[model samples]
Target: MDSFDEAVDSVREAIDRGDNVAVVSDPYGGRDAVADEAEEYTLGVERISFSSVAEADGYEMSFGGQVCVVEGCRYLYTRRVDGFAPVKSFLQTVVESDATFVTTWNSYAWSYAAQATEVDDIFDDVRVPSLSSAEIAELLSSDYDISEFLTDYEEVTADESPSLRERLPFERLRFGIEEASDNVFEKISGMSRGNPGVARAVFESRSWQTDDEPLDLSYDDAFALYVVVSKERVSRDVLRRVVSPDSLETSLRKLSDSGVVGFDGDEVVLRPQQFADAVSYLERRRLVW
Candidate 1:
């Protein structure tokens, strides 16, 4: 059987015995590896890939503020969900719900979690196991066994993936508070410094709070941010400052479709954390500018 199938069988046995499990693994054998296994081994699946913090929070609320227990949900795989804030919030929500959440990513993702005490506690109920490239090589070797591999290796030694770290050029585009247009961007930045969820809400709400305008984020605005922050795909000058919403909805819909933002019909919500995650993945792959 494939590794994913084996994982599903293992998870099924756990569920049959009325057990809750949280599986964490390395870059190679990630949550999806286990998720594929679960789908083959069991029935019923309710899965959502959050791309922004707003969407992540919405997911949390959908399950209720109190813990949301995902019963018989064959699998839950969170890929590259970054930023200290959104990750922490999502983890806490799942932990409080007492649900089984299987997540996977490179080393840096976990390191950031370990540093966030409150965020780290969210996974207190989940078991996180990592497999580095060296370990993967050992697993592929004829002399290696999963048990022996775990015992022989210490923590992973490979470098954490940068895409899983900061979401954008913010790492390279650090601006002084004085450089901020007004104090609001700075404040919003401060609130979401380590948390994408807060930053997303702040960015989207800027229009509503600053001016008496409605919370209408146009496609032009999104394209602007996409090109400006991403600094990859489209040129910065290509973004013209036009206060039009004609194309905004279509663009937001595309983002939401790709799991970058949250869309409930016309309203567009940016899960700063999840958006950061999606952006991280895209940026890592050089899909965006």
Candidate 2:
């Protein structure tokens, strides 16, 4: 079975044993998908989603339900020294409650929380594994006509023209050139490090012929990007709390201009399509683990 299916099965088994489950994955790595599939397999699961610590602070667990699925549990805390109060309170409630809970967490946030609060001891973890190359190909093919793109295994001279197949009229819209190579998906999977979301982003970048230049970031900017990636999506206020305020504005502006991050009103988010590139840049600088 695929990793997602395996995770769902794990969740089912955990629930059957009356155990709370923690579904952990990288940002956009299908934690929600696994949780949703697990929830659908059972009936009468109470679903709750938290976008911020403030929202989590006001939530009260319902003793009436036997199963509950909590999405976005990563939002319950920030990286600041004093930011874990909401998550601590929430975890205390979960420990005290009798209901079995399925909580989804960003892997980075889970790592920090595990170290700080020993949350790994409370919930049975079901980690979502990264997609394989074949899986990545299947996923992209479902949503796109990837046959039109140039393949990595194919070779062509600089003066080579389109083949006869490229001259035919097509009903579906096409991007980039025709003639797909067999190794294109492999290249994408490697570049994305098996992350489905990042693979898709890389595929789109390749298919659309958009080139991403290497990023040159100051230490301040790199640190900021690291925090943003770890948090998944953080508010401007929370970001300021974790990063140095002196260079916060400059770092944010540089990141925003480079298309590594985007703003949603008061919140800053690493753009889904740019995730792989941003992570690669950060990793090279040892800013992200």
Q: What are the root-mean-square deviations of the candidates from the true structure over C-alphas?
A: 17.3, 8.8
Tens-digit lDDT track for model 2 on 1-289? 2677888889999999989989998887888888888778788888888876557755665656788899988878776776777777778888888888899998877877788786788887889987655566678878787666435323321224543433335411111122132467655655565578777777776732455677899998988998788777778887788789989999999999988899999988887666766777776897655
- What TM-score fits each model? 0.32, 0.82
Q: Mark the regions of model 2 whose C-alpha exceeds 4 Å error after superposition.
A: 149-182, 207-211, 284-287
Q: Each model's C-alpha lDDT? A: 0.37, 0.74
* lDDT tens digits by residue: candidate 1, 1-289: 2344445566656545545444443222245555555445444434445433234433543432111223211111122223334555555555555434433332233433455434344432232232222323233333323344333232221334422322344442322221232333333333233222334444445421442212233435454334323211221112222213456546555555554455444334344433334445444544344
Task: Please estimate how well model 1 matches the true structure, expressed as its whole-model Cα lDDT.
Answer: 0.37
Error of 2 at 29 (Å): 0.8
Top candidate (lDDT): 2
